[model samples]
Target: MKKLINNPNHVVEEMIDGYAKAHPQHVRVLSENSRSIVTARETADGKVGVLIGGGSGHEPAFMGYVGPGMADGVAVGNIFASPPPDPILEATKAIDKGAGVIYVYGNYAGDLMNFGMAAELAELEADIQVGKVIVTDDVASAPKEEKEKRRGIAGEFFVTKVAGAASEKGYSLEDVVRVANKANDQTRTMGVGLSPCSLPQTGKPSFELEENEMEIGLGHHGEPGIEKGDLQPADQVADRLVHDILADMPLGEGEKVAVLVNGLGSTTKMELYIVFRRVEQILNEKGIQIHRSFVGDYSTSLEMGGCSVTLIKLDDELTEFVDAPADCPMYVQR
Candidate 1:
């Protein structure tokens, strides 16, 4: 359990603190709640305020997306843990303008509970109207017929990107929610785990795997997946992942889509590129058109080693929103 930190309990605080300082020009901790962060730019008048929140650990996620044309605010929790209602409320309040607020987050039990409570609190006390779009895009977490039961993973990037673009377009809260929900529906993701990550506090791997073994369809928080098997060649691994996602939602000929090859944590660019190489080849063979491609460590699970692939089916409307300009620490679109 090797980690660079003064105290395991203080990792979240220190990380957030350092993030605020490092990107002061683009973000700041809410004065009312340290756990909540808001875009440095003042909330745009009459624009739907976008608030994305969830557990901490997955950096460049819930908070890193805070900036113009992205999330207006974010409520952060402990590593792989949901934040309480208070900070969620603070985040909602910080972003809400007369146009109302939209909450974009993964479809997790804790997030649903806490965000639901915060929405009720905001309506009750501040008279702020709130809308929500919960992302459930991991295909391996559930059967195709049970997508709603799947857990959100790297696909969250596409969901947030579309939602933020809609908000920037001055869509009403209802419309923004609609757009984000549509993105979630069009998105599908699948991940494989080559190694496990240790919680800062636990100082131990959350799960164990034998040497030269891999877990397909593993969740970022170590959720069980389809199966575990001996580590295979990169192309074989990529083929299986791409095949599962395509089977769940067939892309068909000439359909355009966005591709996101994300590193879970310690996976290197070289490995990710190797995976993407196969992904591109597979898509080309299927006659699916790649509208855009993104590759990097957009979402991570502490120091875990593995990666996930996300694809978002796109139409003219979705394509425009995805290409819209956004400025954030982790995501930038010009």
Candidate 2:
């Protein structure tokens, strides 16, 4: 596979170094744990510390969200792999002030196991209180009755944002988790993959697709999607994704919502906006008011060519948190 990376084995380390250097004002790498990034901004002693973690390759995800008004610390793992308990615990320790710490991450097996162990380890060794909120918002991953079984996709962004905002508001650890869980429960996401992503180590695509074929509802790790079919227009794809999500969590007329149209990887901003245009059209036709919309590569899967659309049903509380100021390198809001 053609990639502009150094040794595959060192890609994650090099990336961390580069990111730390580039965004010194926002985050810093823990000297003892390179995979653990702590926000540069100081938080109040009584404020809950927000900690997020997950596998790498989804840049600006677990790490990029670390900063003021967002994640206080992030434990980054290898590409598509869970961070070990050591780094996870290190991240938790780095952010903990005295109140408590909350772990926010996608609902994946490896992530759950590692982060869960880290939480236990922290309590046993450091006497730190910890809580967790798993994001499971991919509507296409499971049936409506089985949302807890669905995988977390771009919807993780909304959950993380709400968690950070809640913590920044000085909410207690339990309240922060409660806010994040509410966001995750209201959020729904669906994606379409036009091409597969290649791993640096293997130098091979995770999956294959024909020039004219696409996989709808594909997971970030090349997990099975709803179906593969001939590629269609961007509007058609957007329609299907929006339809499924809305059906899963229907929005009332005149209801406020937040929209995120995220690129998986190689998908261009031009293409993402095209998808967003259709998304906006659909939401308008449905009388669902979009309070805010974000379009870009917020989350990615190496160089996969695809995009996911996320909608979070917004209430006054959620809107307030979502609008809270944030100053992360990759994601900043005022």
Candidate 3:
């Protein structure tokens, strides 16, 4: 119930204001639409536009990814709520530069509906060609056979990274969409939740867990997970998450991957690194090469206490795009 704010209803507005002010060099709120945030840098002509968005609570996502070599714009929504189609269309129009625009977002019902509506409006009103890629990377959300039904989680970072890079490289809209889908397909993520987060308006915990209990495969919005049990050591938790990911998409001994150990919100960096230590050991034992590793709060749910591990099986194209230079508020790659 403890939150720092003047009014719950105004949290989203205030947040956008503060974010734009803090990172004016990287992003700015659209003059016509308050909910749309676009890159302050000049976009190249004929380069495909990368527009990403979802709910507001998952910071550094949706908004933080908009920059020089990342997403060109974002349609920001309220906390855990899909943005209306107006802002989406606004962002789409702002980013489009004749090469067309592509929408990259998590596989959530609200986002699908809102963004879909925005795409239709863009085509009908502005004659802008728009593409879409829905990230479905949470292996725990569904069986491998039903991957399309899986929910997107921390692995969204990989999808955005690849999509933005492709767009920056002047890929056509079709090609950008193709590479984005490839990234989502190759990525897998699983999370364990130790505590719950309360919404600003509700001021009540979204879910409950016993002091010594934990839930594996929990979604960012306090969705039910696959199993609940007594808390285990960091290594055990890492093993379980990695095991499920590998099972969903088996990797060969010589295959390469990009590892992202993401904190949900309140999880400490020390704990995350400890978990990563075990993850590295496990991968090394299997002779899998880790092309790169990122550990931090890439995507988060308010103040939830948990973390997710994301691995994107990489090939040459993916490696190049992932390693490309990107500068943004929440993430930067040199």
Candidate 4:
């Protein structure tokens, strides 16, 4: 509630405006369409244009990845809300190259509905080919039988990175989708909620938990979690996250992985790193080397105080694309 925002209704617009101004060399925000497209300066003609879309609030997500080596366009919505079909369709049209386009977004109901509609609309009119990869990595979101039913967390980053890179490397639309789906299949995540986020419009906390309690596997919308319990130490929390995520996607001690310890807003980098140290040590004991690692706010739930850990077992091709340079205001590790 103590956010430094201008107004709830205008936050998304204002933020997008500022973002476009500060990173002109990389991207341009389409205010009318509620989307942002990467500068054609970096993406070559006849190459597949990669597009990703989702709600706002999760910074460095649907938008920040649009750059030289990442997404070509992104559709934005209100905080914690899905972008409309118009913007999604516009994004597809804006980014489509002669090769085609791939639409990669997290697995969420609203996003599914909106993006699906947009894709249908685009294919009906334009000569644009589009495919979608739904990121379902949060183990806490559903049981094994319903993994696809789970919501996406921070694992969207790896999906976008690999998928975008595949397209940038001149992969076909189907090929880009194949690699993106592979990235989704090879990833899993788990997280805990220390505090809840407030919807910009409502100006009220989405949910409330006691100071001594934490919710496991909570959705970005602050939905009820898999379980609630008394808060534990950071290491213990990390153990819960690691064991749960790794159990589903078992990591043999000698294997390798690219880890992402992400903050869901309000959770400082200090806490994220505290969790990462334990995660690193645990994976190291298992003989798993980190091919690439990121620790900071990636996808956030507005100002929720929580974190999610993502582990993607890396392969040669994936490693190469992940290492490709990406320049955005939020994730500028080129």
What C-alpha lDDT values do all the predictions have?
0.91, 0.91, 0.93, 0.83
Clashes of 2: 0
RMSD of each: 0.8, 0.9, 0.7, 1.5
Worst 10 residues of 4 by lDDT: 34-43
Off by over 4 Å in 4: 40-42
Clashing residue pairs for model 1: none
lDDT of 3 by residue, 1-334 (tens): 6888989999999999999999999999999999999999889899998999989998877788889778999999999988889999999999999999999888899999999999999999999999999999998899999999999888889998998998888889999999999999899999999999999998999799999999999998999999999999999999999999999899889999999999988999999999999999999999999999999999999999999999999999999999999999878999
- Scored by lDDT, the top model is 3
lDDT, candidate 4, residue 258?
91
- Per-candidate clashes, comma-separated: 0, 0, 0, 1
lDDT by residue for model 1 over 1-334, one digit each (tens)? 7888988889989999999999999999988999999998887689999998899988878778998878999999999999999999998888888888888888899999999999999999999999988899999888888999889999988888898899999898989999899999999999999999999898889688999999999998998888999999999999999999899999899999999999998999999999999999999999999999999998889878999999999999899998998999877889
Model 2 spans with C-alpha error above 4 angstroms: none
TM-score of each: 0.99, 0.98, 0.99, 0.96
Our model 2 lands, by Cα RMSD against the true structure, at 0.9
Model 3 clash pairs are none
Give the CA lDDT, 0 to 100, for residue 205 in model 3.
93
User: What is the Cα-based lDDT of residue 250 in candidate 4?
Assistant: 84
